[model samples]
Target: MVFNRPKKRAIVESGDGGLGLGIATFIANGEDLGPIIRHSFESGKPEALMQNLRSIVKKKEVEIEELCRLHYEDFIFAVDELCGVLVDAR
Candidate 1:
């Protein structure tokens, strides 16, 4: 008998306040967060990057709060719902 393991989802966290909030908001919106974050890190000026991140976080504050406060299962469900919206919109 073979047992299948669950695939691990990548959790992106910058550990800084604004950047982390921005990343979480992007994930909740079903937008890809990797490239922008990568560019920020490579820019060698995290403070400037964080200023931009804060703007994003402010723009999506409500969604960010809702997503952040969810339990793990609820969070997964919420993300799935957002993804469904993306699929339907395309």
Candidate 2:
């Protein structure tokens, strides 16, 4: 079996990691997240974020699967960690 490396995504600029801009830049990706944010906040449902992520990423099955294969561990860990933090704050 062979591994294909994912291209480096520049989600963080120097010194910005501590400022929370890394994830912001990663998710923004040239599109305004305002509507998604407002809707999810208004809906107040955890699935709102999941559904948005599904629509954005799952539409391309091949890429999605490959991405998940490569990134799922780290991604899921981040999600789980954030979930704990978010749930605690609620």
Q: Candidate 2 lDDT, tens digit per residue, 1-90? A: 999865545644334113134334546456465654564567565464555466556556777688889998999999999999999999
Candidate lDDT (C-alpha), each: 0.67, 0.59
Best by lDDT: 1
User: Candidate 2: how many backbone clashes?
Assistant: 0
Query: lDDT score of model 2?
Result: 0.59
> Clash totals for all models, in order?
0, 0
Ten-residue stretch with the least lDDT total in model 2: 14-23
Give the poorly placed runs of model 2, Cα more than 4 Å off: 1-64
TM-score of 1: 0.31
| Residue 70 CA displacement from its true place in model 1, Å | 23
Tens digits of per-residue lDDT for model 1, 1-90: 999865444455565532555455565557786766676778665676668667666877976677777666887899999999999999
